[model samples]
Structure formats: C-alpha cells, structure tokens
Target: MQKLVSEMDNMVLRGEIPQAVAKFFSNSAHTKDVDGSETATKEEAIQKLTGFVGAIAKVNEISLLNSSVGQDVSMSEFRFHFQMEDGSEINWHEVIRRKWKDGQVIDETYFQN
Candidate 1:
C-alpha cells in the first residue's frame, strides 16, 4: 500500500498519467467499480483509468490521513488535490480499499467524497 501511494505520488510529480493508472488497479473489476460502474477486470480497469487520467490536468498532492488493515483488505483515507492551468486547486476526499494478495495489492476501490 505504501509503495502504491509512493509510486502514485512520483507519477503525479512527473505528470505521468499512464504510469499512475497502471499502478492504480490490480484488475479490471477494481477499476470498473471505482468508476461507479459494475465490476471490471484488470484490462477494463486500465482502460477506465486511462480515460480518467486524460481528463485531469495535473495532480499537486495526495495526502493520506489514516489507514486500517483487515485480514485481506486495507482502507485508507486521503485527500487528493490537483492544480489547473488557471492556478486553481481542486480537492477531493477519497477512501481507497485494497485487496492484498501475497502482500501486494491485487485489487483496489476508490471512493470519492
């Protein structure tokens, strides 16, 4: 989980969306659910993330407020902020749920507030 967040932060800093999305999901179902749709597979998740990233300008920061881990799932509360071309800031509260498989995230769900 820490590694995923760190990699995401690095991609944001570099303005690399594709790389960020690649690290965003473990499968398509995870990505589909994140988009407020039905479950998807890894490929579907990748396609969805691709579209989402294309719409956003640049991410300024991702702040994690807290995290809790269960037997197979981990939940994290975070604030995601982005910078627009006009120097405006947009903030969103997010809850990230990750499913662990062999100590790595094999699936993820992102909830926006």
Candidate 2:
C-alpha cells in the first residue's frame, strides 16, 4: 500500500499526468455532488484533472495528508504543489477513495478541494 502511494507521489512529482492517471486510476470514476448527481468515467475524470494540473510547468511536491484502509476500500488525502511558468506556485488538495478488485483499483472517487 505504501509502495502504491509512493508510486503515485512519484508520478505527480514527475508531472507524468497520463501515467499517473493510468497507474493509480480505474476505468470507472465517479463523483456524487451535494445534490446527489454523479459524473462517471475515468476518462472524464482524467481529462478534467489533467486540464487543471497540466496548466502548470512542473510539480514540486506531493504529500500524503492522511489515509484510511478498509476491507476493500482505501481512502486518502494528498496535498500537491506545483511550479508555474512564471515561477509562481500553487497548491491543490485531493481526497481519493479507491475500490480494489483483484488487487488493483477497479473504481475510484476523487474530490478536489
């Protein structure tokens, strides 16, 4: 579990958005809003996140804020720092829940804050 998290950290630090999306994500991603509407699909999720993160030139750091592991679900919070083109910095926070199937992530829910 630590190894997987480390890999994710590395992916983000390297600004390898595609590899990060593929390695840590599943084909089915979903988010339910406060009104209970859901947006699903890993592709869409990746597109949205990549568009947001890709605007930056480089990622400076990824920090694990917290984690909780259940029988088949793992929940984590990560803090991401990025370096922009003009030498500005931005920080983003994400909460992710991964549902494992056969030892791999089969479904995921990611929230950006």
Candidate 3:
C-alpha cells in the first residue's frame, strides 16, 4: 500500500496515465488535488493529472520524503520539482493520503505546502 503512492506519483510525473489508471486506482477511485477541491472519479482523475503533465516542461524529480502505512491506508510526503515552459522551476512539497481496497487506491487526497 505504501509503495502505491510512490508508484502513482512517478506515473503522473512521467505522463504514464494508462499504467497509473490500471495499477494504482480502482474503478470507483476518488481523488482530490488539494484542499477544498471536489473529489474526482477515476477518469476525471486521469484527465486532471494528464493535463498537469502536459502543462509542465519537464519533471526534474519526485522525491519521497516520508511514508507510513496503517490498515488499508498509506500516507506519503514528497517533493515534486518541475520546470515550466518558460524555464522557471517549481517545487511542490505535498503529502498524499490514500485509502486502499483490494490492492488499489479507492480514495486519495493531496495536501500541499
């Protein structure tokens, strides 16, 4: 379960949406990008993330900082660094909380710094 979050982050950062949808999320998965955002369905989640990938110039790294697992849930903190089209860089420090069911994530939320 703990590794799932890391795998999903890599997939998103690398624009591997098909694999991410197939391996990381369940059919009814719900994902919230940040606070106050509506939880999205599997397809919506994929589209949202794919859009993000297209908007970025390059992904420098997705560094996992910490992780913990407890009873069907996994939490991970990661720093995502990427460059914009204009050559500006941004680093996002965020925590992902995921609920797993039958080896797939059914719910996920990202809290950012």
Candidate 4:
C-alpha cells in the first residue's frame, strides 16, 4: 500500500493527474473535497482532477510531506506550490485519505490546510 501511494503521489507531482486517477482509482471510486463537494464515480473524479490540472500554469513545487499506510487505508500529506493560468499563485498543504480495495482506491477525501 505504501508503494502504491508513493507511485500515485509521484504521478501527481509530475502533472500526470488524469493518468494517476485512471490507474489508481477503482471503477466505482468516489471522492470528497475540502469544500464538502463530492464525486460519485471514477469518471467524475477524473474530470475533476483533469480540470484542476488544466488550470495550472506551472508547478513550482510539489512534495510529499508525510505518509502512512494501515490495513486498507492510507493517508498522504502534500505541499503544492503552483501558479494558475489566471495569474494566481497557490501554495497550500493538503492531506488525502484513501480507502483501498483490491489495490485500487475506492474512496478518497481531501483536507486542506
């Protein structure tokens, strides 16, 4: 599980979010965002991730700050520094909790700091 999460994080850091979602998320996967918005399916999750990645002008930095794996659950903390296409800069820390099944993420939730 640790290796799986590490691979997914590396993909995201490399701006391969859509590919990561396609590879790591289960067909019935769902996700919840910090704003309380939720996605009900893997397709929705993919679209959401693609849209987010599309808005990034450049990735200044992205790094994994911490991570832990336990049974069927894993948590990863990430720091993101980026500039948006609209000229806005974003630098924030976020934690993602994932519930896994059959080596794929079935559920994910994000908490931003």
Alpha-carbon TM-score of each model against the true structure: 0.61, 0.60, 0.79, 0.95
Worst 10 residues of 2 by lDDT: 30-39
Segments in model 3 whose C-alpha atoms lie over 4 Å from true places: 2-18, 86-88
Flag clash pairs in model 3.
none
Better of 2 and 3 by lDDT: 3
What would the TM-score be for candidate 1 when compared with the true structure?
A: 0.61
Tens-place lDDT per residue, model 3, 37-69, is: 654677777777667767779878877778788
RMSD of 2: 4.0
- In model 2, the clashing pairs are none
Instruction: Say which candidate scores most in lDDT.
Output: 4
lDDT of 1: 0.64
lDDT of 1 by residue, 13-83 (tens): 46564565565545433442545684456666566656755666778776667777787677777777877
Quote the lDDT for 2 in model 2. 55
Ranking by lDDT: 4, 3, 2, 1
Report RMSD (Å) for each prediction in the order shown.
4.1, 4.0, 2.6, 1.0
Enumerate clash totals for all models, in the order shown: 7, 0, 0, 0
Q: Residue 77 deviation, candidate 3, in Å? A: 1.0
lDDT of each: 0.64, 0.68, 0.77, 0.92
Model 4: clashing residue pairs? none
Flag the better candidate by lDDT, 3 or 4.
4
Badly placed stretches (over 4 Å) of model 4 are none
